[model samples]
Target: MNNHLLRAALDAAERGWHVFPLRPGSKRPALHGEERCPRTGECASGHRKWEERATTDPARIHRAWCGRPFNVGIATGPSGLLVIDLDMPKNNSSSDTPSGVTTFKALCERAGQRVPTTRTVRTASGGMHLYFTAPPGVRLTNTAGTLAPLVDTRAGGGYVVAPGSITPGGSYVVVDDRPVAPLPGWLCEALQGPRRTPQPGPVPLATSASRYAAAALRNETQAVATAADGTRNHTLLRAARALGRLIATGDLTRAEVEEALSRAAAGNATQPERYYDDVIRRGLDWSIAHNSPRRPA
Candidate 1:
């Protein structure tokens, strides 16, 4: 790696961040060039490819190329770094929403922690990247899979929040001086343990039904005007409640609940004009299905 890039990575390490050097050949194809290898001009390794030189000597190549920016290296400061990639949801309706950032902030708030920087590493698409430095001796694997859904790891086209890896040219922004906190003990402990078989929790049937009914009412109101007092609405609402109860108690996964809701709404469609009703039905179904069982009154 370039001395500067390597130094930056080391600096990050000193600050308690984990560092991973980008492979010499990992850059996009267009960036490749016939530069002399750092090891040897005739050497097979770390030569000829722009990405290879960039990876091997990020600072030099970055200054020389001045075209494509460098990917950031993870800093292995006193604390290990937590790298996160922000991704856009596939659905166009919700595509513009800042769900990734919202989710990240929400989780951090819930866990009583904060990210280290607001500087975002922009993706090829217009998504933001955030980074956090964990306390000393903290391990990333401790929360790997559990936190997987919340952030992209860049292993499969997603970008990781690292140094030199994020440059301003590709719509990337690197925020600095943000506060970061240690991961919560409960979350760390839970993540460290083996995945446990999901269990059904005791949920009150009536409460589940009520929550489902409310969710259905909300969906119907959003999709259609006032709901007519009728058997169809009542039946749909009942199904929603049942699904909600299953969801709240961990009896059904989110995917299973969504599928059930889709099926339920499909059966309830009365007219082509009310196609949106199907969407509402599905949403309500999911809402109810995921409702947690109520505690004893």
Candidate 2:
């Protein structure tokens, strides 16, 4: 067992993140297969989904790394994580900006906000993984280039190569030290697309109040980030309403939530401050009308 990989896996487990082994130098899950395994000749077992093999148990992790040093793979769904993958532009087009970075900036601007600097990992390809916790009851699916060109996501059923993991290109390096923030409602809805509504489930308590606020703002940023110009206001208003539910929980005050959301809305120059204020006020109003003072039974 490589002491480095063992330490990394143990650290991740300590943080409550589930992990698994990837082939020594590849992102593919290290599974046994009999058929010809392209990535690693050691595999004799058939193809396997990484999610199914991921685990939080310390013993299992120990077993996986006891003999060979493997790349660390973090399962996103079980770990309550939502990862924004920003890939560098493939070609040197007219613009210097990578499409992913441009699109991500556009998303934040549309939401009138700034993307939270949370736990970030720089990929070997000079890309980045923006780690955020998934909101209670929200299950985002894995996506590629759907949010914008070169922007991908690792949600439920997806696995992100961990920070300490090494690859042929380079190592996945952590760029930020902040804790993972929550996934905001706006971003959640946008990533969800026009698909079926997520079934109602228990809302998990957030790690902290500040993280909760960051999560809410992240959603607002996403909402604005992906929405078209003409419908931006309506989209923001809708996002404000979703945020209202968070305010209703009593962990966050109205002003605090509004301020966070306003920052996300600030990116849009055309929408006056008063417009965002009005939208926020209305959203809060809806929460006040519907939310009970007591927590749900």
Candidate 3:
């Protein structure tokens, strides 16, 4: 038995952080999945997820860790922790792309603030996790590249591996052992700002607006027709915007563009017909507003 790991689990629970077991030398949870559930003991009622089973009880912690030297997994949601993960770039050779730490520091500078001192953990991969108490009544969820490149947040329905966990890559260790700080005001404001929606890309034209409008139309609409489930709406919206730009130059009528886009997007659109219409309407509206009306001479 690894006494060090056992102590680590107990220490996290002492801080009221809900704890669960992760597989030894790995970040994945050790909990049984729903498919493997036997409908007995903990699963008698139903399958309990790792988050639901996470506990702060010392006795349970001792019992779970006594047999194997399991790594610790903390349920950030139940613990009321919002962990900002500053990650390193996957391709280390890329000098042009900035790491999350660099971007996050720049963000703090822009907000006229400094990065808050908190209980920070250095992960096995050398990334840093800044632990903060989430604001009451605000349930933030996980994000991918939401703040900047290689930056992510773990909240409601997310988990983080605690310090003292070791993986094949390296060891998770405490770099700065300061007390977990409250979520900073600047970050809270940033999080609450207007959610940014995805915008369409640059307009497409193979040649002259009049001569190439039909070719452009065929290409864009064809893209929407073959778009798969998750990307279908985005494809439709982009096509609409590109075509709407042609409408602005009087190369294509709005009626024909709308009908062609709608027909192309019908089967593969993720939502109802009304949703497709709204996306098309907004995409076209945005393109028209940004472009000046002109008749091709």
Candidate 4:
């Protein structure tokens, strides 16, 4: 085993961060208990929820790092790290104004606060993981595209690749390497906003608008066809915009609908990455505007 990962693990432990050994070149755990093991039916390695095995114990850290050069993973909630993941455009675009940056700016405008400077990590894909200290009594859950398609969060049960970890794709490097800042009030409130949970008693019937919206979404997803190179973006945008309008009425959650849209867009002969920048992002933005709590008169 190379000393690099071992040294990184020890350093993380020294800093009081709960750490774990991810499989070499992969994010899955290196040591999974029997019941949840992925390698074999009998707990050889790779746990289902590997975050549970994370610890700050030096002895365990030594055992993991000593055996193999595993990638280091920091347990988010346990380590008090709330990460704001801003994924870059998939086309490998290096434009000064990327989709993630644009969306982040829009988010700040909506929230009325700027993101405080803190320890930021640049991921292998050129995206960013903005680290923040979780607030007391705030149980943040992992969410994808809740704020924007490219904006994700790593909270209580989530984990992030530590800065020193190397992967097959690339390395996770610290950009600022500064202390983690506190979760700003605006950002925290946005994350902790009221969720739509299933309540007891009879399930509310889907509204007519919602039913129509769902049917429209299903129809669009099923009808996705091969798109020509020039028309791919337009094709996906049309479908996503229609779905977004339905989503605006509370007919479906953004994640579920986006998944369907993604699968449909990836169908046949079309690539999903081609539509992310101009199609998917704009479609969702349209939905957010129409569905916002304060609807314009």
* Span of ten consecutive residues with least summed lDDT in model 3: 197-206
**Per-residue alpha-carbon lDDT of model 1 for 202-288, expressed as tens digits?**
222233345554454345323222223354455555555655555556554445444444444443445452553455466556666
RMSD of each: 17.1, 16.9, 11.1, 16.9
Q: What is the C-alpha lDDT of each candidate?
A: 0.45, 0.76, 0.85, 0.74
**Cα displacement (Å) at residue 222, model 4:** 42
Highest lDDT model number? 3
| Two-way lDDT contest, 3 vs 4, winner | 3
- Where model 4 places Cα greater than 4 Å from the true spot, the runs are 33-49, 91-97, 194-297
* Clash count, predicted structure 4: 0
Q: Write the per-residue lDDT of candidate 4 for residues 4-54, one digit (tens) a residue.
A: 888888887787788988889877767656574566532345434566678
Return the TM-score for each candidate structure.
Answer: 0.35, 0.59, 0.64, 0.58
Q: Please provide, for model 2 over 1-297, each residue's C-alpha lDDT reduced to its tens digit, 9 standing for 90 to 100.
A: 388998888888888888989899888878654363454422235445567567788888888899998989999998889999998877665566566767888888898878667788999788889999888876688999877878999989888889888988899898887888777667888898875322222223343556766566566656654566688778777877777776777655667656655665665536788887887799778876687476688
lDDT score of residue 267 within candidate 1: 38
Q: After TM-score superposition, what is the CA distance of residue 182 in candidate 1 from its true location, in Å?
A: 4.1
Cα displacement (Å) at residue 130, model 4: 0.7
Question: Which 10 consecutive residues of model 4 have the lowest summed lDDT?
Answer: 196-205
